[model samples]
Target: VAGDEDLPVNIDDLDADFDPKEYDRRMQQIFNDDYYQKGAEEDDVPEVSDEELQ
Candidate 1:
């Protein structure tokens, strides 16, 4: 299971003075990481044609 360490940031740490740019960068990084991981997993799955299903 994913843990807090896997998260980009702790929600409990955010305050009124938090920097938006930093937060955005962290979120983007997380998104990119997840996208890349998903793409990698997809590569392992074999592709099938419509004819194979018929």
Candidate 2:
């Protein structure tokens, strides 16, 4: 998505001149929670709130 957006940092400029550690953090922060889920929802909540018992 290069040239698509004009920002202070260029993600692909790692070899050229850019702090990967800083950029990595920024990128993660931007997509944190909003872009992706923290983890599997099922891990926290059970598949069934209440299962039928025989």
Candidate 3:
């Protein structure tokens, strides 16, 4: 949760108007970032030792 991605809503930004589209976009970005991070971690390959080749 950084910058506008912060879960806590700001009274100043929502003083009068609430944009559902903007909110959805921000949430989607957060989810995508998390999803990619998980994918990158899973893509890592473990090194095999030569001794294990027997």
Candidate 4:
């Protein structure tokens, strides 16, 4: 469960001169992934009517 390949990079290890555009792009990707995951989880649940519960 602890493979080196699966390890996340440390922020302190990043270059001091990292491009601001690259950081923005990476942040956008993370947000997109989170939004997609939430949508996918929501799709798995079934919606029931109030009448059905009665």
Candidate 2 regions with alpha-carbon error over 4 angstroms:
1-17, 37-54
Tens-place lDDT per residue, model 1, 1-54, is 254355555664465467888778766876686767866885897889999989
lDDT of 3 by residue, 1-54 (tens): 354353544564457466888778755765676666866896998899999887
Model 2 earns a TM-score of 0.32
In model 3, which residue pairs have backbone atoms overlapping below 3 Å?
none
Best by TM-score: 1
lDDT computed for candidate 2: 0.53
TM-score, one value per model: 0.36, 0.32, 0.31, 0.33
lDDT scores in order: 0.67, 0.53, 0.65, 0.61
Q: What is the C-alpha RMSD of each candidate to the true structure, in Å?
A: 4.3, 7.5, 6.8, 6.2
Candidate 2, residue 40: the lDDT equals 46
lDDT of 4 by residue, 1-54 (tens): 124343334564275567788778765764566556766886896889999999
Q: Once superposed on the true structure, which residue ranges of model 3 sit more than 4 Å away at CA?
A: 1-17, 36-54
Q: Which ten residues in a row have the lowest lDDT in candidate 1?
A: 1-10
Error of 1 at 45 (Å): 4.1
lDDT-best of 1 and 3: 1
